[model samples]
Target: MSAYAIARLRPFAEPGEDVFTYIERFQSTLDPFGGRFLVHGGQLDEVEGSWPGYAVVIVFPDRATAHAWYQSDAYQELVPLRTRTIEGEVIIVDGVAEDYDPAGMAVRMRAASAGAV
Candidate 1:
């Protein structure tokens, strides 16, 4: 099944200044893992949270791939940079259906939810 790494980060310190150096360094190390940055530091026009902050999401081929990247030496070294700069939550989730069709699943789920035949 395909998987994703999702993170919600809040600047415990300064968003722009505190994290710039380390993130640039970390980005270079991600090359080996096939890590693609889905979202990085960007302006948030809207936030529905107790804490206003930055959100990031990375997509990997599978759960193992995602875990491997995290446990890799490159990421291990760079993780401290994120830890020191941001207060955040990280999660990895398996995308359902292995090859999911969101529109089709939504139709099925809605039918099931509403008891439609």
Candidate 2:
């Protein structure tokens, strides 16, 4: 199953040269790690709580690949640039398979725990 790395960014100030530089360099870093951008920038409609600023979502082949891309030196090098410009949260989550069942997770967890006991 595929995984995703999602970033919700709120910029503290207008983008500058360093921000532009990070954006340009960051694009190339994804391909090497089987990662691709799913959502870069688009109109956000907040149905609930207030959310300000931009959001980005990147898809990877799996959770491991997503973690690798994040921990890679190339991506880490650009972190400071982004941090200097914005405040945001990033998270990696597993994608559901085609046969996904919401209730099955609890059953599976119970079975695994019972086995461990």
Candidate 3:
């Protein structure tokens, strides 16, 4: 199983706080946990619905790994910084694949999501 953490963020009231700095620090903190940053803040050219100010996705080996990272002391400490800098949603999704086809499944998912299938 693969787990993903999806975060949608908004700017905080404090000008001193920012996600870039927090992510930089958090990246180090998460290094020992076997977590990988799949997506961080980048240019957003499309707006289909209510888009957050920032969005991120982190991938982990499993659900336990993702949950442990979130509850870990290191992350717990950094959470306040994230809280100060953003206001939005966070989600953890675990994908269970018995016979996964990375490329084929991804294409199908994209097509389905885009209403092209």
Candidate 4:
């Protein structure tokens, strides 16, 4: 199954030219690991609860690949630059299978919970 790394970022202040440089470098780091940006920009609309700033979604072949890309030395080096400019949260989640169904998921969840009891 595929996986995604999603980021919700709120910039503390306007990004300077160095921020652009960091972005360019960060993008280049993704290609080798089969990671690509799905969404990278400011919010277009807010239908429900507030979204303070931008959102980004990066797709990877699978969860392991997503973790590898995130923990790689090259990407880690740029972490400070990103943290300094923006306050954000990032998470990785596995994608559902092509044949997934809501009912099936509910059943699975119930089974798992029962097992935990």
Whose TM-score is greatest here?
Answer: 4
Model 4, span 22-109: residue lDDT tens: 7989887798889998999855598999888889999999999999999999899888888877889999999999998999889999
lDDT for 17 in candidate 3 is 45
Total clashes for model 2: 0
Which candidate achieves the best lDDT against the true structure?
2
Cα-based lDDT for every prediction: 0.77, 0.91, 0.80, 0.89
Sliding window of 10 residues with minimal summed lDDT for model 3: 11-20
- Worst lDDT window (10 residues) for model 1? 11-20
Q: Order the candidates by TM-score, highest first — what do you get?
A: 4, 2, 3, 1
Candidate 1: lDDT of 75?
Answer: 77
Clash count, predicted structure 4: 0
Better by TM-score, candidate 4 or 3: 4
What's the CA error at residue 29 for candidate 4, in Å? Answer: 1.1
Candidate 4: segments with Cα more than 4 A from true spot: 110-117
lDDT of 1 by residue, 1-117 (tens): 667888888766564653676777776666776778888768776746464777788877789998988888887887776787678898988767656678997898998989965
lDDT of 4 at 24: 82
Q: How many residue pairs clash in each candidate?
A: 0, 0, 0, 0
Residue 44 displacement (Å), model 4 = 3.0
Error of 4 at 50 (Å): 1.0
Candidate 4 TM-score over all chains jointly: 0.88
Error of 4 at 2 (Å): 0.6
Model 2: per-residue Cα lDDT over 19-62, one tens digit each: 89999999888989889889997899899998898889999999
